[model samples]
Target: MTELTVKKREAVGKKVKAIRRQEMVPGVLYGQKQKNEPVAVDKSAFEKAFLAAGETGVINLKIEGADKTVPVMIYALDRDPLTDKITHVDFYRVDLSQAVVAEVPLVFIGQSEAVKNEGGILVTSLKSLEMKSLPGNMPKRIEVDIAGLKTFDDVIYISDLTVPKGVEILNEPETAVASVKPPRTEKEIEAAKEGPAEEPAVEEAAVPADEEKNGGQQPAAEGTERPSEEKKADA
Candidate 1:
Protein backbone atom coordinates (compact mmCIF):
# COMPACT_ATOMS: atom_id res chain seq x y z
CA MET A 1 0.00 0.00 0.00
CA THR A 2 1.15 3.61 -0.68
CA GLU A 3 1.17 6.52 1.73
CA LEU A 4 -1.07 9.57 1.32
CA THR A 5 0.67 12.97 1.13
CA VAL A 6 -0.63 16.00 3.08
CA LYS A 7 0.05 19.71 2.52
CA LYS A 8 2.44 21.94 4.46
CA ARG A 9 0.92 24.21 7.10
CA GLU A 10 2.30 27.43 8.56
CA ALA A 11 -0.48 28.35 10.96
CA VAL A 12 0.30 28.13 14.72
CA GLY A 13 -1.50 29.70 17.67
CA LYS A 14 -4.64 29.43 19.82
CA LYS A 15 -6.47 30.94 16.87
CA VAL A 16 -5.61 27.71 15.05
CA LYS A 17 -9.19 26.81 15.93
CA ALA A 18 -9.83 28.78 12.76
CA ILE A 19 -8.10 25.98 10.86
CA ARG A 20 -10.78 23.54 12.01
CA ARG A 21 -13.41 26.00 10.85
CA GLN A 22 -11.80 25.80 7.42
CA GLU A 23 -12.10 21.96 7.32
CA MET A 24 -8.46 21.15 8.20
CA VAL A 25 -6.70 19.45 11.10
CA PRO A 26 -3.45 20.81 12.60
CA GLY A 27 -0.71 18.30 13.45
CA VAL A 28 3.07 17.80 13.50
CA LEU A 29 5.11 15.19 11.65
CA TYR A 30 8.49 14.21 13.05
CA GLY A 31 10.94 11.31 12.82
CA GLN A 32 13.18 9.47 10.40
CA LYS A 33 14.58 11.86 7.75
CA GLN A 34 12.38 14.89 8.56
CA LYS A 35 12.22 17.65 11.14
CA ASN A 36 9.10 18.37 13.16
CA GLU A 37 6.99 20.58 10.91
CA PRO A 38 3.64 22.17 11.59
CA VAL A 39 1.23 20.84 8.98
CA ALA A 40 -2.47 20.69 8.16
CA VAL A 41 -4.29 17.91 6.34
CA ASP A 42 -7.62 18.08 4.59
CA LYS A 43 -10.24 16.72 6.95
CA SER A 44 -12.05 14.79 4.21
CA ALA A 45 -8.85 13.53 2.63
CA PHE A 46 -7.50 12.41 5.97
CA GLU A 47 -10.71 10.51 6.76
CA LYS A 48 -10.43 8.68 3.46
CA ALA A 49 -6.79 7.83 4.05
CA PHE A 50 -7.45 6.71 7.59
CA LEU A 51 -10.26 4.42 6.46
CA ALA A 52 -8.18 2.96 3.65
CA ALA A 53 -5.08 2.35 5.75
CA GLY A 54 -6.81 1.74 9.10
CA GLU A 55 -4.59 1.81 12.18
CA THR A 56 -1.81 -0.32 10.66
CA GLY A 57 -1.96 1.31 7.28
CA VAL A 58 1.10 3.29 6.15
CA ILE A 59 1.04 6.49 4.19
CA ASN A 60 3.51 8.58 2.18
CA LEU A 61 3.19 12.00 3.87
CA LYS A 62 4.51 14.78 1.64
CA ILE A 63 4.79 18.42 2.63
CA GLU A 64 5.02 21.15 -0.02
CA GLY A 65 8.55 22.35 0.92
CA ALA A 66 9.98 19.16 2.44
CA ASP A 67 13.06 17.79 0.67
CA LYS A 68 11.74 14.24 0.33
CA THR A 69 8.83 11.92 1.10
CA VAL A 70 8.65 10.61 4.66
CA PRO A 71 6.80 7.31 5.17
CA VAL A 72 4.78 7.47 8.39
CA MET A 73 2.35 5.49 10.49
CA ILE A 74 -0.60 6.87 12.34
CA TYR A 75 0.91 6.83 15.83
CA ALA A 76 -1.90 8.53 17.71
CA LEU A 77 -5.50 9.33 16.85
CA ASP A 78 -7.73 11.71 18.80
CA ARG A 79 -11.43 11.72 18.12
CA ASP A 80 -14.66 12.92 19.68
CA PRO A 81 -16.35 9.99 21.34
CA LEU A 82 -19.75 11.65 20.95
CA THR A 83 -19.43 13.05 17.44
CA ASP A 84 -17.14 10.29 16.21
CA LYS A 85 -15.03 12.87 14.38
CA ILE A 86 -11.28 13.26 14.21
CA THR A 87 -10.06 15.99 16.56
CA HIS A 88 -6.30 15.54 16.08
CA VAL A 89 -3.71 13.02 14.98
CA ASP A 90 -0.02 12.30 15.58
CA PHE A 91 2.20 10.75 12.93
CA TYR A 92 5.41 8.98 13.86
CA ARG A 93 8.39 9.42 11.58
CA VAL A 94 9.72 5.99 10.65
CA ASP A 95 12.77 4.86 8.69
CA LEU A 96 11.88 2.34 6.02
CA SER A 97 15.24 0.63 6.58
CA GLN A 98 14.46 0.04 10.29
CA ALA A 99 11.97 -2.41 11.74
CA VAL A 100 9.03 -1.18 13.85
CA VAL A 101 6.93 -3.15 16.27
CA ALA A 102 3.13 -2.82 16.11
CA GLU A 103 -0.01 -4.83 16.71
CA VAL A 104 -1.78 -6.30 13.68
CA PRO A 105 -5.38 -7.53 13.74
CA LEU A 106 -6.25 -11.22 13.25
CA VAL A 107 -8.84 -12.29 10.71
CA PHE A 108 -10.37 -15.75 11.00
CA ILE A 109 -11.10 -17.55 7.77
CA GLY A 110 -13.49 -20.55 7.28
CA GLN A 111 -16.03 -21.83 9.75
CA SER A 112 -14.98 -24.58 12.09
CA GLU A 113 -16.81 -27.82 11.46
CA ALA A 114 -17.07 -28.35 15.17
CA VAL A 115 -18.96 -25.11 15.36
CA LYS A 116 -21.17 -25.90 12.37
CA ASN A 117 -21.99 -29.63 12.42
CA GLU A 118 -21.88 -30.15 16.18
CA GLY A 119 -23.11 -28.09 19.10
CA GLY A 120 -20.01 -26.10 19.92
CA ILE A 121 -18.91 -22.56 20.43
CA LEU A 122 -15.93 -20.81 18.88
CA VAL A 123 -14.11 -18.65 21.40
CA THR A 124 -11.39 -16.18 20.49
CA SER A 125 -8.79 -15.49 23.12
CA LEU A 126 -6.71 -13.06 21.09
CA LYS A 127 -7.83 -10.23 18.87
CA SER A 128 -4.50 -9.05 17.56
CA LEU A 129 -0.80 -9.84 17.61
CA GLU A 130 2.39 -7.79 17.95
CA MET A 131 5.06 -8.06 15.28
CA LYS A 132 8.31 -6.39 14.31
CA SER A 133 8.58 -5.52 10.65
CA LEU A 134 10.07 -2.81 8.50
CA PRO A 135 7.67 -0.15 7.27
CA GLY A 136 7.84 -1.55 3.73
CA ASN A 137 7.28 -5.12 4.97
CA MET A 138 4.24 -4.54 7.18
CA PRO A 139 1.20 -6.76 6.61
CA LYS A 140 -2.38 -5.55 6.60
CA ARG A 141 -3.54 -8.40 8.82
CA ILE A 142 -2.77 -12.00 9.84
CA GLU A 143 -5.12 -14.74 8.66
CA VAL A 144 -6.05 -17.81 10.75
CA ASP A 145 -7.75 -20.96 9.49
CA ILE A 146 -10.43 -22.53 11.68
CA ALA A 147 -11.73 -25.17 9.27
CA GLY A 148 -9.86 -28.02 10.94
CA LEU A 149 -11.39 -27.36 14.34
CA LYS A 150 -14.10 -30.00 14.64
CA THR A 151 -14.19 -30.86 18.33
CA PHE A 152 -14.23 -29.21 21.72
CA ASP A 153 -10.62 -30.23 22.28
CA ASP A 154 -9.39 -28.40 19.19
CA VAL A 155 -7.50 -25.16 19.74
CA ILE A 156 -5.40 -22.92 17.52
CA TYR A 157 -2.12 -21.72 18.99
CA ILE A 158 -0.15 -18.61 18.25
CA SER A 159 2.88 -20.63 17.19
CA ASP A 160 0.87 -22.30 14.44
CA LEU A 161 0.48 -19.11 12.41
CA THR A 162 2.45 -18.72 9.19
CA VAL A 163 3.96 -15.23 9.27
CA PRO A 164 5.10 -13.42 6.20
CA LYS A 165 8.75 -12.64 5.46
CA GLY A 166 10.18 -9.69 7.41
CA VAL A 167 7.47 -10.02 10.03
CA GLU A 168 8.06 -11.67 13.40
CA ILE A 169 5.40 -12.79 15.88
CA LEU A 170 6.10 -11.45 19.38
CA ASN A 171 3.96 -13.77 21.53
CA GLU A 172 4.59 -17.06 23.29
CA PRO A 173 4.20 -20.26 21.28
CA GLU A 174 1.76 -21.81 23.78
CA THR A 175 -0.68 -18.93 23.69
CA ALA A 176 -4.10 -19.99 22.45
CA VAL A 177 -5.69 -17.72 19.87
CA ALA A 178 -8.99 -19.56 19.46
CA SER A 179 -10.74 -22.71 20.65
CA VAL A 180 -13.86 -24.77 20.07
CA LYS A 181 -15.84 -25.81 23.13
CA PRO A 182 -19.07 -27.69 23.68
CA PRO A 183 -22.00 -25.33 23.96
CA ARG A 184 -24.38 -25.36 26.89
CA THR A 185 -26.90 -28.15 26.23
CA GLU A 186 -30.61 -27.86 27.00
CA LYS A 187 -30.15 -29.92 30.17
CA GLU A 188 -27.32 -27.68 31.30
CA ILE A 189 -29.44 -24.62 30.74
CA GLU A 190 -32.31 -26.15 32.75
CA ALA A 191 -29.92 -27.10 35.52
CA ALA A 192 -28.63 -23.58 35.70
CA LYS A 193 -32.15 -22.19 35.76
CA GLU A 194 -33.33 -24.67 38.43
CA GLY A 195 -30.40 -23.99 40.75
CA PRO A 196 -29.86 -26.51 43.61
CA ALA A 197 -32.50 -29.04 44.74
CA GLU A 198 -33.15 -29.44 48.48
CA GLU A 199 -33.52 -32.93 50.03
CA PRO A 200 -36.59 -33.53 52.26
CA ALA A 201 -35.92 -34.21 55.99
CA VAL A 202 -37.28 -37.63 57.20
CA GLU A 203 -37.20 -36.76 60.93
CA GLU A 204 -39.66 -33.89 60.75
CA ALA A 205 -42.75 -36.05 59.94
CA ALA A 206 -43.09 -37.70 63.49
CA VAL A 207 -45.68 -35.90 65.70
CA PRO A 208 -44.91 -35.56 69.44
CA ALA A 209 -47.34 -37.14 72.08
CA ASP A 210 -47.53 -33.89 74.12
CA GLU A 211 -49.14 -32.06 71.26
CA GLU A 212 -51.70 -34.92 70.85
CA LYS A 213 -52.50 -34.91 74.63
CA ASN A 214 -53.46 -31.21 74.46
CA GLY A 215 -56.00 -31.81 71.66
CA GLY A 216 -58.95 -32.98 74.01
CA GLN A 217 -59.82 -36.59 72.96
CA GLN A 218 -61.59 -37.40 76.34
CA PRO A 219 -60.07 -40.03 78.72
CA ALA A 220 -61.72 -43.53 78.46
CA ALA A 221 -65.26 -42.35 79.51
CA GLU A 222 -64.39 -43.07 83.18
CA GLY A 223 -65.76 -46.63 84.16
CA THR A 224 -69.37 -45.94 83.05
CA GLU A 225 -70.67 -49.63 83.16
CA ARG A 226 -68.59 -51.82 85.47
CA PRO A 227 -71.11 -51.91 88.46
CA SER A 228 -72.74 -55.36 87.63
CA GLU A 229 -69.51 -57.35 88.04
CA GLU A 230 -68.79 -55.67 91.42
CA LYS A 231 -72.39 -56.51 92.74
CA LYS A 232 -72.06 -60.22 91.84
CA ALA A 233 -68.75 -60.45 93.77
CA ASP A 234 -70.42 -58.91 96.89
CA ALA A 235 -73.44 -61.46 96.76
Candidate 2:
Protein backbone atom coordinates (compact mmCIF):
# COMPACT_ATOMS: atom_id res chain seq x y z
CA MET A 1 0.00 0.00 0.00
CA THR A 2 1.14 3.56 -0.72
CA GLU A 3 1.57 5.93 2.21
CA LEU A 4 0.73 9.69 2.08
CA THR A 5 0.92 12.26 4.88
CA VAL A 6 -1.71 15.02 5.18
CA LYS A 7 -2.56 17.81 7.62
CA LYS A 8 -5.85 18.87 9.15
CA ARG A 9 -7.27 21.60 6.94
CA GLU A 10 -9.06 24.63 8.41
CA ALA A 11 -9.39 26.26 5.00
CA VAL A 12 -12.91 26.23 3.55
CA GLY A 13 -14.92 28.07 0.86
CA LYS A 14 -12.80 30.78 -0.80
CA LYS A 15 -10.03 30.31 1.72
CA VAL A 16 -9.23 26.91 0.11
CA LYS A 17 -7.61 28.83 -2.75
CA ALA A 18 -4.96 29.96 -0.29
CA ILE A 19 -4.04 26.32 0.37
CA ARG A 20 -3.46 25.70 -3.36
CA ARG A 21 -1.29 28.76 -3.59
CA GLN A 22 0.92 27.16 -0.91
CA GLU A 23 1.34 23.93 -2.94
CA MET A 24 -1.31 22.07 -1.00
CA VAL A 25 -4.56 20.44 -2.15
CA PRO A 26 -7.72 20.49 -0.04
CA GLY A 27 -9.64 17.22 0.31
CA VAL A 28 -12.25 15.49 2.44
CA LEU A 29 -12.15 11.96 3.88
CA TYR A 30 -15.31 10.08 4.74
CA GLY A 31 -16.82 6.59 4.66
CA GLN A 32 -19.76 4.58 5.90
CA LYS A 33 -20.47 5.65 9.49
CA GLN A 34 -17.45 7.94 9.32
CA LYS A 35 -17.38 11.67 9.91
CA ASN A 36 -16.22 13.93 7.10
CA GLU A 37 -12.77 15.31 7.90
CA PRO A 38 -11.18 18.09 5.90
CA VAL A 39 -7.49 17.61 5.15
CA ALA A 40 -4.65 19.02 3.10
CA VAL A 41 -1.77 17.24 1.43
CA ASP A 42 1.27 18.31 -0.56
CA LYS A 43 0.43 18.60 -4.26
CA SER A 44 3.50 16.64 -5.34
CA ALA A 45 3.00 13.87 -2.80
CA PHE A 46 -0.68 13.54 -3.64
CA GLU A 47 0.04 13.25 -7.35
CA LYS A 48 2.64 10.56 -6.79
CA ALA A 49 0.37 8.56 -4.50
CA PHE A 50 -2.55 8.88 -6.92
CA LEU A 51 -0.44 7.64 -9.78
CA ALA A 52 0.71 4.59 -7.86
CA ALA A 53 -2.59 3.66 -6.22
CA GLY A 54 -5.03 4.69 -8.96
CA GLU A 55 -8.64 4.69 -7.64
CA THR A 56 -8.83 1.10 -6.39
CA GLY A 57 -5.51 0.54 -4.65
CA VAL A 58 -5.60 1.26 -0.91
CA ILE A 59 -3.37 3.93 0.60
CA ASN A 60 -2.13 4.44 4.18
CA LEU A 61 -3.16 8.06 4.81
CA LYS A 62 -1.33 9.59 7.76
CA ILE A 63 -2.89 12.73 9.21
CA GLU A 64 -0.73 15.19 11.10
CA GLY A 65 -1.20 15.03 14.90
CA ALA A 66 -3.20 11.76 14.49
CA ASP A 67 -1.99 8.64 16.28
CA LYS A 68 -2.92 6.09 13.62
CA THR A 69 -2.98 6.06 9.79
CA VAL A 70 -6.21 5.52 7.86
CA PRO A 71 -6.57 3.00 5.01
CA VAL A 72 -8.38 4.84 2.24
CA MET A 73 -8.86 4.85 -1.52
CA ILE A 74 -9.07 7.85 -3.79
CA TYR A 75 -12.79 8.36 -4.38
CA ALA A 76 -13.00 11.34 -6.69
CA LEU A 77 -11.02 14.26 -8.10
CA ASP A 78 -11.64 17.74 -9.48
CA ARG A 79 -9.17 19.10 -12.02
CA ASP A 80 -8.52 22.47 -13.62
CA PRO A 81 -10.01 22.63 -17.12
CA LEU A 82 -6.94 24.19 -18.70
CA THR A 83 -3.96 22.84 -16.71
CA ASP A 84 -5.57 19.54 -15.65
CA LYS A 85 -4.22 20.07 -12.15
CA ILE A 86 -5.92 18.49 -9.19
CA THR A 87 -8.12 21.17 -7.58
CA HIS A 88 -9.83 19.00 -4.98
CA VAL A 89 -10.12 15.36 -4.00
CA ASP A 90 -12.22 12.93 -1.96
CA PHE A 91 -11.02 9.91 0.00
CA TYR A 92 -13.05 6.99 1.22
CA ARG A 93 -11.97 4.98 4.24
CA VAL A 94 -12.17 1.21 3.89
CA ASP A 95 -12.44 -1.61 6.39
CA LEU A 96 -9.80 -4.24 5.83
CA SER A 97 -12.13 -7.17 6.36
CA GLN A 98 -15.00 -5.86 4.28
CA ALA A 99 -15.42 -6.48 0.56
CA VAL A 100 -15.36 -3.51 -1.78
CA VAL A 101 -16.62 -3.15 -5.34
CA ALA A 102 -14.10 -1.86 -7.85
CA GLU A 103 -13.54 -1.93 -11.55
CA VAL A 104 -10.32 -3.69 -12.55
CA PRO A 105 -8.78 -2.82 -15.89
CA LEU A 106 -8.37 -5.73 -18.33
CA VAL A 107 -4.89 -6.07 -19.76
CA PHE A 108 -4.74 -8.14 -22.94
CA ILE A 109 -1.65 -10.29 -23.28
CA GLY A 110 -0.31 -12.58 -26.05
CA GLN A 111 -1.16 -12.40 -29.73
CA SER A 112 -4.11 -14.37 -31.08
CA GLU A 113 -3.42 -16.89 -33.84
CA ALA A 114 -6.46 -15.64 -35.78
CA VAL A 115 -5.02 -12.15 -35.84
CA LYS A 116 -1.41 -13.18 -36.41
CA ASN A 117 -1.90 -16.00 -38.93
CA GLU A 118 -5.34 -15.38 -40.48
CA GLY A 119 -5.31 -11.56 -40.52
CA GLY A 120 -8.49 -11.38 -38.43
CA ILE A 121 -9.28 -8.34 -36.30
CA LEU A 122 -9.32 -8.66 -32.52
CA VAL A 123 -12.42 -7.11 -30.99
CA THR A 124 -12.62 -6.42 -27.27
CA SER A 125 -16.08 -5.80 -25.94
CA LEU A 126 -15.06 -5.05 -22.36
CA LYS A 127 -12.32 -2.75 -21.16
CA SER A 128 -12.74 -3.57 -17.47
CA LEU A 129 -14.53 -5.90 -15.12
CA GLU A 130 -16.48 -4.90 -12.02
CA MET A 131 -15.70 -7.19 -9.10
CA LYS A 132 -16.01 -7.38 -5.34
CA SER A 133 -13.05 -8.32 -3.15
CA LEU A 134 -11.13 -7.28 -0.07
CA PRO A 135 -8.84 -4.32 -0.71
CA GLY A 136 -5.79 -6.52 -0.25
CA ASN A 137 -7.11 -9.11 -2.68
CA MET A 138 -8.06 -6.58 -5.34
CA PRO A 139 -5.64 -6.82 -8.26
CA LYS A 140 -4.15 -3.77 -9.99
CA ARG A 141 -5.29 -5.24 -13.30
CA ILE A 142 -6.64 -8.48 -14.73
CA GLU A 143 -4.59 -10.22 -17.39
CA VAL A 144 -6.52 -11.78 -20.31
CA ASP A 145 -4.59 -14.10 -22.61
CA ILE A 146 -5.77 -14.09 -26.22
CA ALA A 147 -3.68 -17.03 -27.35
CA GLY A 148 -6.72 -19.32 -27.24
CA LEU A 149 -8.43 -17.35 -29.99
CA LYS A 150 -7.15 -19.45 -32.89
CA THR A 151 -10.18 -18.89 -35.11
CA PHE A 152 -12.81 -16.21 -35.86
CA ASP A 153 -15.45 -18.33 -34.11
CA ASP A 154 -13.52 -18.43 -30.82
CA VAL A 155 -14.69 -16.07 -28.04
CA ILE A 156 -13.66 -15.30 -24.47
CA TYR A 157 -16.52 -14.70 -22.11
CA ILE A 158 -16.73 -13.36 -18.56
CA SER A 159 -17.26 -16.91 -17.34
CA ASP A 160 -13.99 -17.95 -18.92
CA LEU A 161 -11.89 -15.58 -16.82
CA THR A 162 -9.77 -16.88 -13.90
CA VAL A 163 -9.54 -14.56 -10.90
CA PRO A 164 -8.25 -14.60 -7.35
CA LYS A 165 -10.09 -16.80 -4.86
CA GLY A 166 -11.79 -13.91 -3.09
CA VAL A 167 -12.66 -11.86 -6.18
CA GLU A 168 -16.16 -12.19 -7.64
CA ILE A 169 -16.83 -10.76 -11.09
CA LEU A 170 -20.19 -8.98 -11.32
CA ASN A 171 -20.59 -9.08 -15.09
CA GLU A 172 -22.99 -11.48 -16.78
CA PRO A 173 -21.50 -14.88 -17.51
CA GLU A 174 -22.63 -14.67 -21.17
CA THR A 175 -20.87 -11.36 -21.76
CA ALA A 176 -18.16 -11.65 -24.40
CA VAL A 177 -14.90 -10.10 -23.30
CA ALA A 178 -12.94 -10.57 -26.53
CA SER A 179 -13.28 -12.22 -29.95
CA VAL A 180 -11.65 -12.44 -33.35
CA LYS A 181 -13.52 -11.00 -36.34
CA PRO A 182 -13.04 -12.33 -39.86
CA PRO A 183 -10.84 -10.19 -42.08
CA ARG A 184 -12.62 -7.71 -44.35
CA THR A 185 -12.65 -8.48 -48.11
CA GLU A 186 -10.63 -6.39 -50.55
CA LYS A 187 -13.82 -4.76 -51.94
CA GLU A 188 -14.98 -3.80 -48.46
CA ILE A 189 -11.59 -2.27 -47.67
CA GLU A 190 -11.65 -0.24 -50.89
CA ALA A 191 -15.19 0.99 -50.21
CA ALA A 192 -14.20 2.08 -46.71
CA LYS A 193 -11.19 3.97 -48.07
CA GLU A 194 -13.27 5.75 -50.70
CA GLY A 195 -16.12 6.60 -48.31
CA PRO A 196 -19.81 7.01 -49.32
CA ALA A 197 -20.50 8.04 -52.94
CA GLU A 198 -21.81 11.60 -53.39
CA GLU A 199 -25.38 11.99 -54.61
CA PRO A 200 -25.97 13.22 -58.22
CA ALA A 201 -26.79 16.92 -58.49
CA VAL A 202 -30.27 17.71 -59.82
CA GLU A 203 -30.36 20.20 -62.72
CA GLU A 204 -33.06 22.89 -62.77
CA ALA A 205 -35.08 23.35 -65.98
CA ALA A 206 -34.06 26.47 -67.99
CA VAL A 207 -36.81 29.12 -68.19
CA PRO A 208 -37.21 31.68 -71.01
CA ALA A 209 -36.62 35.30 -69.93
CA ASP A 210 -39.93 36.36 -71.40
CA GLU A 211 -41.81 33.61 -69.51
CA GLU A 212 -40.22 34.73 -66.24
CA LYS A 213 -41.30 38.36 -66.85
CA ASN A 214 -44.85 37.24 -67.79
CA GLY A 215 -45.41 35.18 -64.60
CA GLY A 216 -44.48 31.81 -66.22
CA GLN A 217 -46.83 32.20 -69.28
CA GLN A 218 -44.95 31.24 -72.43
CA PRO A 219 -45.16 33.51 -75.52
CA ALA A 220 -46.95 32.19 -78.70
CA ALA A 221 -44.80 30.30 -81.23
CA GLU A 222 -43.66 32.23 -84.34
CA GLY A 223 -46.21 30.46 -86.73
CA THR A 224 -49.07 30.51 -84.18
CA GLU A 225 -51.49 33.50 -84.62
CA ARG A 226 -52.55 35.71 -81.71
CA PRO A 227 -56.24 36.00 -80.60
CA SER A 228 -56.54 39.41 -82.29
CA GLU A 229 -55.09 38.17 -85.57
CA GLU A 230 -57.41 35.11 -85.66
CA LYS A 231 -60.47 37.40 -85.02
CA LYS A 232 -59.43 39.69 -87.88
CA ALA A 233 -58.98 36.71 -90.21
CA ASP A 234 -62.45 35.34 -89.31
CA ALA A 235 -64.05 38.79 -89.97
Structural similarity to truth (TM-score) of each candidate: 0.74, 0.80
Q: What is the C-alpha lDDT of each candidate?
A: 0.82, 0.93
Per-residue lDDT of candidate 1, residues 1-235 (tens digit) = 6656677677778876888899998788877666787778899888888887767768888877677777789888888799887877788888788899888899999999999989688999999999899977778789999987878888899988898887888889899999998889899899999999889766764555754784543334456643456797997
Q: Which candidate achieves the best lDDT against the true structure? A: 2
Candidate 2 segments whose C-alpha is farther than 4 A from its true place:
203-235
**For each candidate, C-alpha RMSD in Å?**
9.0, 4.6
lDDT of 2 by residue, 1-235 (tens): 7999999999899999999999999999999798999999999999999889988899999999989999998888999999999999999999999999998899999999999999999999999999899987887789999999999999999999999898999999899999999999999999999999999999999899989986687887889964675798998
TM-score: model 2 vs. ground truth: 0.80
Backbone clashes, each candidate? 3, 0
Residue-level error in angstroms, candidate 2, position 200: 2.0
Q: What value of lDDT does candidate 2 attain over all alpha carbons?
A: 0.93
